[model samples]
Target: MRTTPVERPTVLRRRSYTWFPVVSGAGFYVAAIALPLEHGDGFASAILLTGISYFCWLIGWNSSFRFTRTHVSVTNVLVTTTADWRDVAGVDIEGGLAGLLRDGRSLDSIAFGGSLIGEFTGYRTHRRACRLLRQGWWGAGPGRRGKGPVPVRTSVEWRRALAIATALYVPVVLVQGLGG
Candidate 1:
């Protein structure tokens, strides 16, 4: 009798919303260069605005790309990130915007659960996973053997990533705005 070897699924590639930062940054730089220089303090303001825009752009672009490119491998024994494999306790799959907001109270519930009024409570990785699953892009299926790749996350992940990127860039922009 012939038997077929079970194929192990691995993440061949990964991508994130990395273009946002790049495009924003490029626009900032272009504007900075193209904008007319005004006399006295206004010149400084233009320069500052340009700098802030560039800073925001870089942060958004880098973080988005970095998070998206991250990949993992699933195995019988464990799941692996780029560096190490740890025993995963569980996988929580939160739906997308519709899933989370379906009740129109999910946002409030999430805030209450986390015990913070406006704290960002999502991870980009989670959103990516959810998206892949929804599109049936994860490439995993049912097997009598065991549980397949678990899905977890929501669009909040993207929001969090954006928030973080913005936070990092905002201060610098503000400072420049003030000084300029």
Candidate 2:
């Protein structure tokens, strides 16, 4: 007997939050200019602020790129994509930040649920698969509803990237915090 292949769900096309990049980039630029003027520690401060600002801008740019893609299709076999792809086994949405903290990396598997706020509105995904994809992009995994990964931001690869960024921003943030 011949068997027919199962049809995959139609892929959904969604773009990443556009406002995040714009707002973040603008904020960074302003900080870059304002920091030196207020702090004025010579070229070092200027360079530091500029570098920090550029890094923020790059984050925004990368976010935009990450979200901008043709389409994403979830199939019975596997998730298919023509654009950059990330995947998690499942997803679950529970309490607020408090719950998230308790869940740990397990929550990382699923996309965190929350109300649309500020520049994050555009990033909202109603579909489970889409949410999982976004979480994966953010370095989180997909988890079964009600169940989550071990800890948030536990992805070693993503953690490394974040660590690098944090290391670069530490001085700048400290200076800013110190009223510089």
Give the winner by TM-score.
1
Q: Write the per-residue lDDT of candidate 1 for residues 80-178, one digit (tens) a residue.
A: 222111112212344322122111222111111221321356644345544642233222233212244433323233454456456544654554455
Q: TM-score for model 1? A: 0.33
Kindly report which residue pairs in candidate 1 clash with one another. Answer: 21-61, 92-152, 93-152, 94-153
Q: Go through the candidates in order and give each one's C-alpha lDDT.
A: 0.36, 0.38
Candidate 2 root-mean-square deviation in Å: 12.6
lDDT of 2 at 161: 45
Query: Ten residues in a row with the worst lDDT in model 1?
Result: 75-84
Top-lDDT structure, candidate number: 2
lDDT of 2 at 145: 38
Please give, for residues 64-165, the per-residue lDDT of candidate 2 as tens digits: 112222222221111111222232233343331111222343222111234446125543353444464455444433333344433212112344445655
Off by over 4 Å in 1: 1-17, 65-83, 87-91, 95-180
lDDT, candidate 1, equals 0.36
